[model samples]
Target: MNVTGDDVRSLALSLPETTEQFAWGMPIFKVSGKLFLTLPEGETSMAVRCPILDRDELVLAEPAKFWIAAHEAGNAWVRVYLSALDDREELTAIVTDSWRQAAPRALLDSP
Candidate 1:
């Protein structure tokens, strides 16, 4: 029941200023030119940016739903398990937050 890369791409496209690109062979989503999330090629996880303090809490609460990429290991970002996200509300919150973090401050301050 793993969600495909297209599913991730579609979700990102629905966000404001989100555009897709390749970063380290992964599908990276950006908002106003800043990266927010990435689904690495041939991998089973997703790289999602989060407030530094929130990383441990999220992973501890749902280990199955979260992990950190080896490269980004121990960083603020966590790799969320796409298959574990069946709850639309929670997913929406995370995706929206990602967009907010990636979006420029001017855009956020604007309207």
Candidate 2:
């Protein structure tokens, strides 16, 4: 619900071993040095790690909520429209899932 880049940043940093770094002129969140999410230039949307298969299905299922930037095509990432999120729960789940994907196995094993 009206998720902003700050919402994204706070959530991402709340996860274990996550850090914020700037790359390609945007903010990127990484887990143990592995990139997990990115807040593009306008911060209207965020890109998160997603299996290519799942990304395609998501984009097709909810084009307004999810998409793959042309430059990001062929990569295992999907962009979520912050404005399109249904609620904070959805945002948390999405961000956490991306964190899980990039987090070290040791971190995943912990609570």
Each candidate's clash count: 0, 0
State the number of backbone clashes in model 2: 0
Task: Report residue 37 deviation for candidate 1 (angstroms).
Answer: 0.7
**lDDT score for candidate 2 against the true structure:** 0.94
* Residue 69, model 2: Cα distance from true site in angstroms: 0.8
Per-residue alpha-carbon lDDT of candidate 2 for residues 1-111, written as tens digits (9 for 90 to 100): 788999999999998899999999999999999999999958999999999999999999999999999998989999999999999999999999999998899989987
TM-scores of the models, in the given order?
Answer: 0.85, 0.97
Tell me the TM-score of model 1. 0.85
Candidate 1 off by > 4 Å: 41-43
Which 10-residue span in candidate 2 carries the lowest summed lDDT? Answer: 102-111
lDDT of 1 by residue, 1-111 (tens): 466667777888998778888777777888988888888746456777897678878878889987666777656688888778866666677777878877888877886
